[model samples]
Target: MIKGKGYLKFSKSKNKIYVYLFGRLTGEEKKKNLFAFGRLENALENMYQIRESDRLPAELSELGFNFDDLDEWILALETRTTRNNKKINLPVIEERCFEDVTNYDLLGMSEKEVKSLNKDETFKMYSDLLEMIFGALAHIEELEEIEEG
Candidate 1:
């Protein structure tokens, strides 16, 4: 029942879904898993395209998630609740936006060009730019606090 904007690896065992975020299993106790994508469109396309036929077990077909909306699936996971009052462990969407912006190529553009392109009229580009700005700001604040301490 994991959702959000990135790649997720999952499997169903004993009527439960075991989700892995950013290539690491849930048992690892990692706080966050970074995704590399320039825009939310790219991220959503990758996330929603996952079908139950991909990696799910035969028993999971009866679960509601097989036909549920992506957002609903995410919500269910976040609350750790199933439709039938069962508890399920799932991956969390640490951040709705991609984390590793540098990992994506801006179509062979230079740094300056990339910055300029971010000002384009496309809504997707603007959204990505905003997310990147906030993420950078948070990182800077964390670094400053670490240095001060």
Candidate 2:
């Protein structure tokens, strides 16, 4: 399995189903992939419009996310505050929270594995990965390391 800092895992156990967020891509990286990030941002913004909680899983499904699989663990939704400072909690299935991941590996796929996927599959894979990475990036503010002046 390709383990890295910038990945999300949505797993289902006999008793529970959940999503965990790992590391996030840097600002430069996000800029280079603006289209993907744009979709994610738009999605988040759109999510606020539908205030119903029960519809989230179905909504995620419509957006190419299948929560039934174990290995596909891929979302860590946070309650986002709007410009007016109103909190919007868009829950997926169960509890959603971010786990600290210190590594910087972007994709866990190998060359052969990536090559084997069809064009549509490849695009979906990238979209999903970017969605997760972008989601994490949008929620948290990255801190800069300050050296002694």
Candidate 3:
């Protein structure tokens, strides 16, 4: 599942915690699963806090979640909160045309030879570059948040 941003708001009037999950809800099953996982997290945390004074409950396995499932849930929570809520102002990513790279011989290859490569190769390279750029931006945002906090 792709990570999406979400917010948990405590509604005093309704006496309920309202969760706002920002993502595509394609089916009823998916929506139910998401809500269940969120509630499970809250319950687990509350139970652990009540049971243990300072230390964490012995490795979540004791708390009833299989280690693998716990890891997956933690990963999903992090992805949703960190990637979705964290905002970054990035420069417009420029899409390079075939002509743009023609001037430079990539890997010392001639312009003609480079141009002969399939469009897939060119697109793959661009995608990898953009991924790296976004990763760096995310890291920077995390660092700023840490410092501010």
- The sequence of per-residue lDDT tens digits that candidate 1 reaches over residues 1-78 is 223322333443443234533423334444344323123224333333443235433323322234344444433333
lDDT of 3 by residue, 1-149 (tens): 32332222222122223222233233323422233223322533443333335443353333343444444334333333333455322222223344566555443556665566565665555445445654565577579779999
* Residue range 54-106, candidate 2, lDDT tens digits: 24445234334333321222123332333335543322322111112223244
Ranking by lDDT: 3, 1, 2
Flag clash pairs in model 1. none
- Report RMSD (Å) for each prediction in the order shown: 17.4, 19.7, 15.9
Q: Whose TM-score is greatest here?
A: 3
Better model by lDDT: candidate 1 vs candidate 2? 1
In model 2, which residue pairs have backbone atoms overlapping below 3 Å? 2-108, 5-23, 9-73, 9-74, 10-73, 10-74
Candidate 3 Cα lDDT to native: 0.40
lDDT of each: 0.39, 0.36, 0.40
Best-to-worst ranking by TM-score: 3, 2, 1
TM-score of each: 0.22, 0.25, 0.29
RMSD of 3: 15.9
